[model samples]
Target: IADQDEHCKKFMEALIPEAFRKLQCSHPIDHWAGWL
Candidate 1:
């Protein structure tokens, strides 16, 4: 369970940035509005 958790954490660390960048590029105004 701990190992799975660690792997998930690493995966999320890598995925979140790319996902966020895509979201930002695809919807800049909406993303910023929701983020803010």
Candidate 2:
């Protein structure tokens, strides 16, 4: 978002974070005892 492209920022902001969230959410490491 620090770049000069407003359109790119908005498009990437919506798309990139969603991809990472799904990737992180699907990871099975959350089930571990020290996961806290």
Q: Identify the leading candidate in terms of lDDT.
A: 1
Among all windows of ten consecutive residues in candidate 2, which has the lowest summed lDDT? Answer: 26-35
TM-score of each: 0.67, 0.48
Which stretches of model 1 miss by more than 4 angstroms? 28-36
**4-29 per-residue lDDT for model 1 (tens digits):** 99999999999999999988788978
Stretch of 10 with least lDDT, candidate 1: 23-32
lDDT (0-100) at residue 26 of candidate 2? 71
Per-candidate clashes, comma-separated: 0, 0
Error of 2 at 8 (Å): 0.7
Tens-digit lDDT track for model 2 on 1-36? 556698888899999999999878877565664587
Cα lDDT computed for each candidate against the true fold: 0.92, 0.81
Error of 2 at 23 (Å): 0.6
Off by over 4 Å in 2: 1-4, 29-36
